[model samples]
Target: MKIALIAHDEKKKDMIQFTTAYSPILKSHQLYATGTTGALISKKTGLPVHKVKSGPLGGDQQIGAKVANNEIDIVIFFKDPLTAQPHEPDISALMRLCDVYLIPLATNMATAEVMVKGLEHGDLSWREIVKEQEGNDI
Candidate 1:
């Protein structure tokens, strides 16, 4: 499965810790992240992550397009709600696309933990099922 990892500046530390703890499970899947977050994760966990632009510089939009195209199966976005983001519209659009595409999304640590465990336990096997069906349809 293709999974996206995004974190706000304030949440990068938590994201790093979470990724570190889940590196074994994560290494089995394709991972992507916004620029600085990707760099940091790669440095800390040694997991290869496809890096896109910084969020304010259009990273969220890029991921949104992937979601629309069915290229992304899961999204783990750690947003800092207490801070105001200049590119709030892009964030909203990315989130809305996740809903529209039926992608699994985690916006907080608690939900993220569940999603990670679900991934590890084959609870997210439906992503593969859906992909297989799509391939058959074509």
Candidate 2:
């Protein structure tokens, strides 16, 4: 499974903690993340991550493209709702793509915890079926 990890500036600490705590479950799969978030997670947890641009600098759009292509299976974005984001449109597009593609997305820690656990238990194996169907269509 390919998992995307993103976080707002204010929520970066939380994202780091979450990744560190779940490193055991996360290390088995591919990990993708936005710039600073990816750097931090990699530094703290030593998990190899494919890093894209900073979210404000088009990382969200990059991830959205992956979702559209069915290359991403899960998204864990720890957004800071209290703070207004300058790149709101990009964020919205990424989230909308997740919905359109039926990818699992977690906007908060609680939801992320559940999704990570689900991944550990193979609950997300359905993504492979979806990918196979996509290939057949192609």
Strongest candidate by TM-score = 2
Q: Candidate 1, TM-score vs. the true structure?
A: 0.97
TM-score of each: 0.97, 0.98
lDDT of 1 by residue, 1-138 (tens): 999999999999999999999999999999999999999999999999999999999999999999998999999999999999999999999999999989999998899999999999999999889988988999
Tens digits of lDDT, candidate 2, 12-103 = 99999999999999999999999999999999999999999999999999999999988899999999999999999999999999998899
lDDT of each: 0.96, 0.97
Global lDDT of model 1: 0.96
